[model samples]
Target: TKMDKHNLTVLNEFILMGITDRPELQAPLFGLFLIVYMISVVGNMGIIILTKMDSKLQTPMYFFLRHLAITDLGYSTVVGPKMLVNFVVDENTISYYFCATQLAFFTVFITSELFILSAMSYDRSVAMCNPLLYTVIMSQRTCWMLVAIPYLYRTIVSLLITIKIFNLCFCGYSVIRHFYCDGLPLVSLLCSNTHEIELIILILAAFDFILSLLIVLVSYLLILAAILRMNSAEGRHKAFSTCGSHLTVVVVFYGTLSFMYLQPKSSHSFDTDKMASIFYTLVIPVLNPLIYSLRNKDVKYALHRTLGALCNIFSQSSVYHVFH
Candidate 1:
């Protein structure tokens, strides 16, 4: 038994029970998650590259979008690959140190994504409500600051949470039912009293959720009001078109997250929690790039332009090779 400074025994590693132990389910689960992971990485990477290459997309909206894509890519990569490995491998064990690291990074990116969404909502509000002032208000420096603030804040908070939680002594139970080292799952495994930790988490989570929701809600309300004031039908359609994709993403992301975290701890069900985690972890990341690219004409145009240029370059290379 490993003794801590408090003389409490701690575990060195944990066996993840994952979604299911059934042999029949393993193969199908692996295949499904593999497809989702691939799409997430490719789609998010495409968005980042497209945004960078297309000067037209250098606005505040796409600035947040680029960071959001990066965060989604990071978040999905942090969680998906480990889970994928677990599905294929016979032993689904994770070192204590690695689990803590996963939780920290997961917290950072997930929180960053939430804040990025809030920033996007604010950008939409400004664009719709004060079109003439949008450029002045969302200057390049301002946009970079907005993106940087979330990463800074979330990183600090995640570190505190990680340190505090890991300090708690884990009892004899080393099996975490969930695939990843989630906050609640880790809390549940602790042998010591978790009242203080639970309270801290609840307060932090509520504040984060409430703040982001308010920003999104208030921004959209003003956006709606602005849309109603528009004289031209085309103008109103354009405003709605720009905001629709973001609103859809916010709903899906917050819906899954709220369902996962907002409930009473006593009512926590591992099976249901795992399902909710899958939506945000696997489904939302894949859907985000699709929603933005498919709905926004700018992104579609940028993608087409980039691909066309690449094809032209390839064709020229082929012709040169033939001549040589």
Candidate 2:
């Protein structure tokens, strides 16, 4: 154990070869991602603020949505700034402990998000299938539990995996091919046999993926059945509208993730993986708030109400200052 611990410190740091290696492309790419990161931060933050401020949004759907926005903001914050810095700098180095920390937090947020989406799906199913008992079934206490369990579960899982990955002996070469310190990329750098670590990553990823996806699939199926049985065209249309934004989000998030992680190892390319990672890490966060705000009339109304209230407050303050 002592020797293994000693060996772990052999590689003091890792150099992150970012999204692109082309000399000319770095600055333009940097500018592009800067805009993306800004949009993501603003969009997710707006969702969070709107959900908190609007009485109309004080429902289970918005409750789940608020957490989803938090996670989108969390993981993006973890990866975006550092990657942006790397884009402009000469040496894209991350220290041993810092890399481990990045991996851990990234894992927690990403995994928690996966389960949260599933929870949202289940919430939708209840709303559609058992409208009478929806409130009773998804009470404030229940919503808190649904959100809490995922964060706790993912924290423990991230801790164990981070410890396991860092415990392995890395060869002299400490260059990671991806933008962020991802598990598989780190595992690939090990001088020791990587079979066990690789297996652990694969098993955990597969399990999380399948389990959460099953929840979503089953939930949507129930919603579909409920929708089909509706006697009125208006009711059916309303049901579809209620589920549309969430369904779109689920499809985009899961589709990018599945393409990135579910493929055979033989087909794995770091470049291709980087593209998929960008879609989720940067693109999805921007897309989510836009998707929800644009699709849901409730959110749009909340935004207008919130802006009106702010404007009134500003005008009143200006008038007071002018008189003083």
lDDT of 1 by residue, 1-324 (tens): 322435445678999888888999999989999999999999999999999989898888998999999999988999999999999889899999999999999999998999999999999999888889999998999888888988998899899899999998887778888999888889887878899988888888888889989999999999999999999999999889899999999999999998988778799888889999988988999999999999999999999999999999999999999999
Candidate 2 lDDT over residue span 1-324, tens digit each: 123423454778999999988979999999999999999999999999999999999999999999999999999999999999988999899999999999999999998999999999999999999999999999999999999998998999999999999987887778899999999889878877889888888898999999999999999999999999999999999999999999999999999999998788899999899999999999999999999999999999999999999999999999999999
Worst 10 residues of 1 by lDDT: 1-10
Give the TM-scores of the predictions, in the order they appear: 0.96, 0.97
lDDT, candidates in the order shown: 0.91, 0.94
Candidate 1, residue 133: the lDDT equals: 94
Error of 1 at 260 (Å): 1.2
